[model samples]
Target chain A: MFRLEVRSSTPTWFNFALPLLAIGATLILCSGLIALAGAGVLEAYGVMFTASLGDSYAITETMVRATPMIFTGLAVAVAFRAKFWNIGAEGQLLAGAVASCFVGAIPMPGPLAMVLMAVAGAAAGAAVALVPATLRVKFKVDDVVSSLLLNSVIYYALMALIEGPWKDSFSGYPISPPIEDSANFPVLLEGTRLHLGVVAALIAAPLIWFLIVRTTLGFRIRVTGENPEAARYGGIHVERVLISTALLSGALAGLAGVSEVGGVHFQVMSDISPGYGYSGIVVAMLARLNPLGVVPAAIFLAAVMTGAEAMSRATGVPAFLSDVIQGTALLAMLVALLFTAYRIRRVGVAR
Target chain B: MSAVFEQIFQVGFLAAIIRIATPLAFATLGEMFSERAGVLNLGIEGIMLLSAMTGFTAASLSGSLWLGVLAAVLTGMLMGALHALFTVVLGLSQHVCGIGVTLFSSGLAYFLYRLIFGQQSVPPNIKGFQTLPIPILSDIPVLGPAVFNQFALVYMAILAIPVAAFVLYRTPWGLSVRMVGENPRAADSAGVSVIATRFQAVILGGALMGLAGAFLSMAQFNAFTFGVVSGRGWVAIALVVFGRWDPWRSAGAALLFAFVDALQLRMQASGLGHIPYEAFLMLPFIFTIVAMAVMSRNAVAPSALLKPFRREER
Candidate 1:
């Protein structure tokens, strides 16, 4: 039998190398599926990698896709850093979208209206997040279950809004009416759908890093996540820090919702988010829960999704193949990371 | 008072509640077993999805409901083994790996379903499990049919409560599971194999989750949709917490939630467009969160719920 022995310390270079290795392994694994699906492996890979980054327009589209992921990924990373599993980012993003939609539908000056939409979106997301956070802190409820359950509830609620009160008048479909021109995000590039939301994500990355690394709140949050009892003993208000982190996390996720509405969709729809909130969890994990690392991680995932779309159109392969890659990549990464901390050795007796 | 009682207890009201609660009961019991053994398998959701599709596909092809059910259970066990490999052997984080399992399984199921079924205008259906009424017992007034006449899976779901309770408390394996969950180091010192026990518990629990999913597609609906198992798996997770990780209490909570869920549906039907159906849909989840809030205050999770145990760590 082989037994795994824990390493005293993993080398620094190895820590960075594992992600690249995992990506390679994921590609090889996915290639097998592609072959089974009767798609040309090289052609599919070519479309996935180059199509998304092949041209200026494609890059902007990729950024548009990455925008929400950046916020949601940062949201997950922030909460995870403090050991809070904010799995309800999906719900929070919906709430943000709901608020942004309601605010944007009102006729007003475009600039002021857009500002209000973002604020409302963030506030609404934070408020929804606090529900589970408060329950966990005050009533000892498991945040994981509550937050996850809330996602379903929020999705249904969004559906109710679109299907009933806010149903699109012209199409008679389950979609909210289009936002006022004033509320629409300004296109960042002349010919691309890239919007102000991308800028927000770019700004948020460093701001989140500073919050986690430099602020007193960051110290308390890190301590609480590492050891709540020790944080309490060391004069940190662990509950308060956790609650605040939850709020910040929700707010970031909410910003993702606002970005989607103001930047891309321009209206709340039934299928507003294609599991972006859940995908954020993967992004955070891939980035190893580092706030700054989440930026590149979100971009990478966004590229995969964008490429999957191009691949599907190009090869007739189902777009969900991207989900397969994302999910499997996480498992592969986990095993690769495991080897970094431990090594397999022959045990009992050399047979 | 008679009229009020009659209105609240319509002809098929009790039956509807039981039918709705069956899947949840199975899932809740399954989750409880895993949690009791110190592994919280969030893969319950994805397992349900995988089994739903597999059971539906197998039943439709073979025209045998039993075979479909078996296929679902096997698929669930396979996913469970994967989960066990991560949490029990690799000692990875429970929630992360569980979520990963869910994503992988659900994605795989969806991909396969789409690949095989493609985009059909009308989704295919199969001959589902027929109701098996207990003789004499099923004929006893309103109580008789509601309680005794149900799918075989429903009867098994109910039986699972006591059987699970017995195995967890009465059997030697039960003691080992409890010991491992509460304190793995101590359990290891006492000659219990923590990894083996956890693996068995997770796989067993996963099979039940498969049953729950099969119950939806192969027994209740007779057809499968992407939304067939929607939110029920998460409800099971909440029920386990609300039930305080006890099989009996978990069953009771599942029944109660189902009752409320049935009532909400009835109310929606009666209200006839006055109340948003979504509000009614939200009832079970909202109630679950509230129940967890109240129940969690007094109920503690298993001591080693998410902790990975290593014999040499101490």
Candidate 2:
């Protein structure tokens, strides 16, 4: 009943249509899950979409949530494009947050202090990544394991810091002291949580696109990712490029940490991030590791995260359902993307 | 000096380490099977977490720890089957599949925990499994009590080491599994059902993972918390690589992790502790990375570990 179709490569239209198809499938599946959770799919979706976009305040909150995801998604995308799996972005983000916390606690001029803190945050995130990168380059260690283990260390370290030396004595809370006003990112809109981090991320998206498309380094990266032996034959420094890209990727993730601390929370807490690093993987994958595509993907993820609370409060559905949806979407996207590249060929006549 | 020896010689401390190491050892051994079969199951953390929650809930409801353990194992098997369906049958990326599984399971576990337990501040507690000391060995000094005095699950975990080692090395089935991991085409050529073997291994590994989760809830804590599994699954993953896919060696690596864990808890409890507990808490992770860096030089991962094995014609 089905006709055989042959095409040399996937067209641009197919590329755009694939994500749409994945989303359509995701929404239908999620609706079923929502109904299973004892909520009307329409009502649940209404509350979610409305609460996330109905008001200016809601939009700002969505942006605030999305800011770090943008950086993290880009971070993951950069490494993924280079065929390097840096699963340690969560740890690196924490490293940046911890480092910025240290910097923010220091007394200095406001603008200058903020700049220095961002730099330190980036450096700390990159430094934590160095362990995995160095091991991958020197000992051929799998970055996946090293990076994943580093997350546990970072988590414990943050926990220890908040519970001990960095504890907020005045408030009797397990949170770090608030950053100095000078170290805070200026809010972009009055009376809203949106801040300069959004601008930074926006600027970064285009810059990343440019770097990957218009530079000599980009050529090396694409060549290496496509074929390592071929890239080496072409006289590219494969190891150096991989290491530098990894560092750059980690720095972006660290900057996301800075955004959380400087532009949103103004202080580090044990729960500073709600697993944004992990969620970033979905964003990166959904965007197909295209840097420019990461923006909208991140925003969509942020919208889901932001709306989860409302969904929980209104429908009595746990907000974690959003996580399930995000994860399902990622799985669906991966499957769909795979099908796009390869199709199963029947060896025998149809029965 | 004798007092120092006496203090260090307490059977309780050593027994506690063994107890703690049991689940980690089980999970690490399980991961070794999957990794050796050429799939990196990062969903281990999620699998353990979900199984822990399900086992705890089931045990609390049924008032039977054994039933609870069974439920956990079944849940783990379900997750493993799901993973196999996605990664093997559907041919999805293992890493993404793992992350998706983790997210889905974690969310499901958390939601179910809230739905069943309600919004109570204090968590519910249940009767935990008691220790079953070997009668004859209980009377012996040092090694006897240390090895003999443990929960039923602990003994099972200990037995699993040799069983796993035997299956992995001395058996033809083990050779087929290794061949699938190293070269699927060759395995397929030799009449080994690559997909079937991989699916079997993944599910088998998943069952052990579930048992490990059950041990945490039914034996170790007698309570369930959101963070019960913590990062133990990640530690298990590291142990797999560090152990070089050998069950005994992986178990040894697991014991080292337990030592660090036990030492941290002990240091936290000790009044004479010098370092911040955070520093101590970070020790295992830091050491894991450093050790991986050092040992990875000569380490040989399974040739097909993270790569999807597609038939050449595709």
Candidate 3:
């Protein structure tokens, strides 16, 4: 019989190979569902791949989709590095969208409006995140439940806005009015939806990576997460680090909403996000909490999301196969992480 | 405000509170059992959604409501086992794994549902549970109709509180669950199986959550809409904290939240105020957060709640 034994160290290739292996395993595992759906697995996956990454237009669409996840993935990666459980990224994202939308609606110079939107969105997100951090630090509240509950509170608030005052009075649709035309994020490519936010998201990843790898705050965050008591002993302000981490993380998530509002929809709505905040957790885990890894992870999920609809139409397989793949990828990645800590040893035959 | 109060004092209002609380109570109790065993099942939201779908499908297809409930409970047990396999057996991070379970289950539910039912303009629904009033209890005036006249699943939830209390506080297995949750190493030294007890507790918890799902789809909504379990599972999680993980208290928390919820519905129905309906929907969540802030100082979570037990670790 084989059993897991703690490993002293792992090889460097494990990092690169593990995620690929997990993704490969996830695809293979989900193939069973495709077969059950009475469709040829290969044909379905082909449809999915071609539909998501095939042409320039499709590629642009996927990039647009990946933008928010990139931001959120960074948010989660940052917070988790400090061992701060922040599940309210969804709420923060909404807060950002609302703030940015409010800013965008005010008639102003295009460049100025854009700048103000990002700042306001990020600030709003940081403010919402502050509540949980402050609660955890001062009131001894568990951040997990409090942060999670905030998502619903924010959601209802958003619904109230759109359904009430923000309602499109003419059509009676519960949608916020479009932002000033000048405030719309300029599309990067002609005839494609690729916006400035995509570029910003791409650049933000490496910048975040740098900050995490090369900064004093990053070191403190890492140390704090690894051992709070040790961090305290080492003269790191543990509680301060937590609050700082929360602000940074929340700001990143807020930018996700800002980009979506500024670059894509240009207005807020009830279904503004299709659970991108939760997807950030999946992306962060698959990245092993590495900010640089978040880009590819976000792209992978984006492709699945973009492709699922096409796959549904082509092979008649349910598009939710993408969702299942996301969950499986996360679980598989978590399992693969086991390799970093332990190895299987066969004790019976060794002697 | 007086009109709203008038709406609240009636037998109908009490009955509404029971209807709303039934599902929340089951879910809260389910989560409480899992947490008591030191496994926080963040998979709850997705589990309830999946269970609702499966239960509705079974009942609609077989023309048997009880069969739907059985299907839901089994679904919960299976998913719970899956969760246990990851967190308990592999000793993975409970937080991320729970989220994964939720995402996975919710995805599977949606995929299978679409494959089986196909997309239609109107969602398919089934004939749901009918309330069976308790004989002597129903004869009593206001409390009777509100508390006694409920579906079988609702009755089960009410009975489940005391039963859960007995099992948790009095039984040997219950002690083992508590032991594992609070101090696994000591329990292991005492020869109690931490792994097994935790698995059983989580599984039992999943079964109860399944009943909650069954209540939603088969009784309350009478259909498996995507929004059928909308945030109730999360609300239940909050209620567990509010109730301090005690069965009776958790059930009481459920009732209290239900009271707030029923009041919101009543106010909206009365159309007496200019307040947006969404404002009312936000109350339960805000209430929970505020309550947590107030009660957090005195409330203590199980020490081993998020910790994974590995005998080899120092």
Instruction: Give TM per candidate.
Output: 0.96, 0.95, 0.98
Error of 1 at B280 (Å): 0.2
Clashes of each: 1, 1, 0
**lDDT (Cα, tens digit) per residue for candidate 3, span B152-251:** 9888988999999999999999999999999999999999988999999999989998999999999999999888888898888878888998999999
User: Tens digits of per-residue lDDT for model 1 on B103-156?
Assistant: 888877877787777878999898898889999999899888898988898898
Candidate 1 - CAPRI tier? medium
Q: Least lDDT summed over 10 consecutive residues: which range in candidate 3 chain B? A: B1-10
lDDT of 3 by residue, A1-351 (tens): 898888999998887888999999999999999999999999999988999999889999999999999999999999999989998899999999999999999999999999999999999999888889989988888887888989988999999999998886766889898889999999999999999999999999999999999999999999999999999999999999999999999999999999999999999999999999999999998898999999999999999999999999999999999999999999999999999999999879655
- Candidate 1 colliding pairs, count: 1
Predictions in order: lDDT: 0.89, 0.85, 0.92
Fnat for model 3 comes to 0.85
Better of 1 and 3 by DockQ: 3
TM-score of 3: 0.98
